[model samples]
Target: MTVRFFNFTDGQNVKLTAERGGYSVIEYQSDMSVNPYEAQLAYFASKMNVRRRQLVCHLDRFPSHCVSMQAGAMQWMSGDVQPKTGIRGAGDFARKLVRGSVTGESAIKPEYEGTGIVTLEPTYKFILLEDVTDWNGGIIIEDGAYLSSDASLTHRAEMISRPSAAIAGGEGLFNLGLYGNGLVALESSVPREELIVADLYDDVIKIDGSLAIAWSPTLQFTVERTTKSLIGSAASGEGLVNVYRGTGRIMFAPVATGHVSSASTGA
Candidate 1:
């Protein structure tokens, strides 16, 4: 297969091509060679925070984002050494979706191209460090976004806001939300095409469990117990679960419900 690249700086785009059957690596300028300990020092030196404009990398495939952690960047950026670990990536902070590809040095990743899949084409953007209102240790989100700590509550609330949607009941409990005009990223066990997205404005929808990845912040989330629980919830299939309310949208993967693993969170 042939590979190609387009370089853009300050809004200018430059196209570059790769040799047939060859691969190209994307990394920070000096990241590839810096010592892990030393890199960490530089990273911390850049204001004691992980984000450094001069140090981060601007790459294709998913807009411009920070490359690996300072140490990982050092290994991958420099000529020949493979990274020993994952970069302290900003994408991981928000459970941002990742494009399927061979990114880690230890394994071969899938290459994604020409497909407008959500995994590779997330609608989330970084909340500039300079403009943060409340710096939550986790993901950075905009005003109208709310992440789902537990699936049931988030999914139901999103449903209350929307109408006629279904999500996997088996995928475990975990999801992130974005609203207003910001970007959101999430990890997906299934590819974008396989995932389902239902938009609702003024209706309610219900499903067996929580598997939604995102919803609008306007929606409200809560927990509810099945009617059986009051008398004999054990007899009924449904149990105590999380709930949602209000209006917005929900994105989820019903196929992998309940089975979602933490290993895939920032994959």
Candidate 2:
């Protein structure tokens, strides 16, 4: 089967932003305003330096392979495509339900198979096409990062070992973990150009805020005082900090990034 996109070219309204083994990131440009009131606000939004482009991903499937994505993420599909819930049995459904409850992720991720092209919904946030095999077959991501992945990969919920760390680190108690081989799509608050990656080798890295978006599951994560002594910690103007110890890699946004708040403040 052949696939073609109209009004979309290499550097026109749609552009190929990133690609890996299994998926590709397609950036589409469109006017952010739909009505007259929004048009006026869009002018101000542009002046304020707000981003307007939307990010979507295109997945190519083979006859024997499939693609799995977050529930309700499919915008459209073409060619001979069949979709399923990826539930093998009752035990698998139960496990997925529990994992979804703990990690705040969708339990029934939809899977598309057969030779086809699948398009995901558009979003203002940036898209990351990551190869899970690079992280030794497992990676832990922050809440809401999971977008889509090759059907070969599996998802689960991982909990922080220490209650104090989960309470004070600002990373919550549970995170979504992806394992196995294949490419994964992530919706990131910050663009890939602004992400910082650090590879540690039997060392430790500390951050004062919840900036790390994804990290290797092999790394030990915890929260600890900035200094060993309470007096020193107070004098340093820092208290507890999120710490990652061991050999692994971490990717994080250097600055704060998230959805923009509505302009209407209910004045």
Candidate 3:
């Protein structure tokens, strides 16, 4: 089969950002013609670092390395690729339904198999690619951050050890968890360049908000008062904070001035 792709070559408006483990992040720069109003808006948007980005998944012929994506994320595909619901039976469907409910993800994420190129819909959010091995074979990502992942990875909804802590921290009851090996793609409002990766070894980290986008599941996360005493906490002008203890790494966007979301919910 012959395939020809345009606007992907050098000097094109659309360019590759990074490619690894069968996933490629393609960025669409603001080079297209637009109306005067749109031109002004795009100009300001570019100044704020907002741009269109897409995720591409390269599937091998082998079924073991197939890819699964959000229900409607696929924009287009080429080659002899085939998509399935990835449902084996009724029991599996029920499990997935519960998982989706808790994780804030699609229940039936479609799985693509065979050799092909699949492109996801473009969005203003940043596309991030991560390898599970880098997070010690498991990762807990914020809700709505998941885009796609190699089929080899196991996905589940992870509940916090302390549900009250989640409520106090302004977090959800559960998070999307990915385990095993392979690459996973995510959607983030903030670019990775602005993110801070904190690697801890039998240590602890605390934050006043839900700033963490992803973290190793090995970390014990909870919400606690800034100070043991409520009066002291009030005096400090800080209340409950998200605390992560044990050995692990967390990817968080620093709280800063300007327009930036405190967490990466892809909102």
Candidate lDDT (C-alpha), each: 0.29, 0.76, 0.82
TM-score computed on alpha carbons, candidate 2: 0.86
Weakest ten-residue segment in model 1 by summed lDDT? 148-157
User: Which run of 10 residues does model 2 get worst, by summed lDDT?
Assistant: 258-267
lDDT of 1 by residue, 123-238 (tens): 11111111011211122221122211111111111123111211222222223321222122223334455667665666544544655544445445444555635566556767
* Model 2, position 71: C-alpha lDDT score: 86
Ranking by TM-score: 3, 2, 1
Superposed by TM-score, candidate 3 places the C-alpha of residue 55 at a distance from the truth, in angstroms, of 0.6
Kindly list the per-residue Cα lDDT of model 2 for residues 1-267, writing each as its tens digit. Answer: 576767644655466767666576765444443698788766665465344433233444432368888887787777778899899999999999999988988989989887667777766667787887888899999888888888878787888768675786566788999899777888776778889999999999998878888999989888788999989989999888888899999998888865544211112
Q: Which ten residues in a row have the lowest lDDT in candidate 3?
A: 257-266
**Would you estimate the TM-scores of all the predictions?**
0.36, 0.86, 0.91
Which residue ranges in model 2 land beyond 4 Å of their true spot? 1-4, 8-11, 40-64, 259-267
Native-structure RMSD, model 1:
17.3
Clashing pairs in 3: none
Cα shift from native, residue 181, model 1 (Å) = 3.2
Candidate 3 runs further than 4 Å off: 9-11, 31-33, 61-63, 256-267
Q: Report the C-alpha lDDT of model 3 over 83-158, residue by residue, as the tens digit.
A: 8999879999999999999878999999998888888887777778898989989999988888899898898888
